[model samples]
Target: MGQVRDQRGDHIRDQSDDQSPDESTRKETSMQDSILQEGINEVIGTTHLNAAPMGIILRGGRHTLALFKRSHTAANIVGDGWFVANLIHDPVIYVESAFGDLPDDAFTTEIIDGTPMHRLAAAEAWVAFRAEVIGESSEAYSILLTPIKEEVLVRSIRPVNRGFNAIIEAAVHATRYIMNHDPELEWLIRHHLALARKCGGEREKEAAGMVERFIGEDSL
Candidate 1:
């Protein structure tokens, strides 16, 4: 057994890296089958129990995370060696989490392989993975995560909603614009906001309003 400290300097028990060779192979196969699409999803980490939107990539049939070096998600995963990847479709979740730490009520915990892990309460599905930081650079770290456990929480089938899609795009741009102050990103945010207002449902409209408040662009 081993232990690591989160960003808050609190000790957390590390999940053992030891795995039977056959067990490792089986888990890898499962990861390739389910995580076929590479896209953005909310990642919940134990460091302050924070949730952040991150991109999950499928490279050579293995799931990988290229995390920013300065992010709380990176710090938490580096220290804990494990985290949960949430498949969520709500624009509210994406917008709220992109801006700041979500309220405590938004999360729930489960014990996976004896280690308690945090996950989004509204995730459509969830996967538990053990991560290894395989590469690093000045700006970010490349991580390889293998699925150890997974479950589907919601099974609803719905048609594609462009309004929801627009809100997601807006949320992504809003987060980047806050950090870099790039004028292009702001323009993109407004463009997406317009799409949301024109095409999105009530929830999407609400999300667009949140994005406006988030970036101090009430003029939208």
Candidate 2:
């Protein structure tokens, strides 16, 4: 087996020769797909288990997150050098975590590669990784997460719902709008809210309401 250094100059094994036929086929299929996948994810870091909804970018073989400067996620990852990215399908989780901390019941502790880490109890999948800050700007820290352990906790088939997707989109914009109070972001939030109301189920409608409440209805 060969070895390569990551952005942090840490030696990482090249697993190309160790893969079985199934794993090799999966790798080929993944490479054929779009290299970038963006989604809202729950990130848990710090010993206190600080949780937040953040945008996760999966490009090539690395998972990356752009942590806003001064945010708890940035501070925790910098201090501890590790965190977990959780795949959460619930819009309520996104809206609540985006605004503030989630309740204690929302989290559960599990050992990943012999290290205890906090993860979302409702996560469909979770990846525990070491954070290597590859770059930084005045606004945010660019981090490359090297996965040490990953697991899919649940697998279920569900049809796509536009309303649910709209809620996710609104929550993403709302997270930024609350910080800058940008009028354009506010419009996007309301636009998604409308779609959620028109097409979503009760849960989507409730989640949209939470977003509106957090962003303040007076401005709308």
Best by lDDT: 1
Best by TM-score: 1
TM-score of model 2 vs. true structure: 0.76
Which runs of model 1 end up more than 4 angstroms from their true locations? Answer: 1-32, 35-48, 217-220
How many clashing residue pairs are found in candidate 2?
A: 0
Off by over 4 Å in 2: 1-48, 217-220
Q: Tens digit of lDDT per residue, candidate 1, span 1-220?
A: 0111111111222222333335556554345455336553334333337887765665455666776767777877888888677887787877777766788878888887788888888888888787776666666677767777788889889789889989978876776676567889989999999999999988899999988887785223
For candidate 1, the TM-score is 0.80
lDDT against the true structure, per candidate, is: 0.69, 0.65
**Residue range 1-220, candidate 2, lDDT tens digits:** 0111011111222233332335453343232322125542334332247776655566454566676656777777888777777776777776677666678888888776566788888887777776656667666677766666677778878689999889878877876676578899889999999999998998888899888887775355
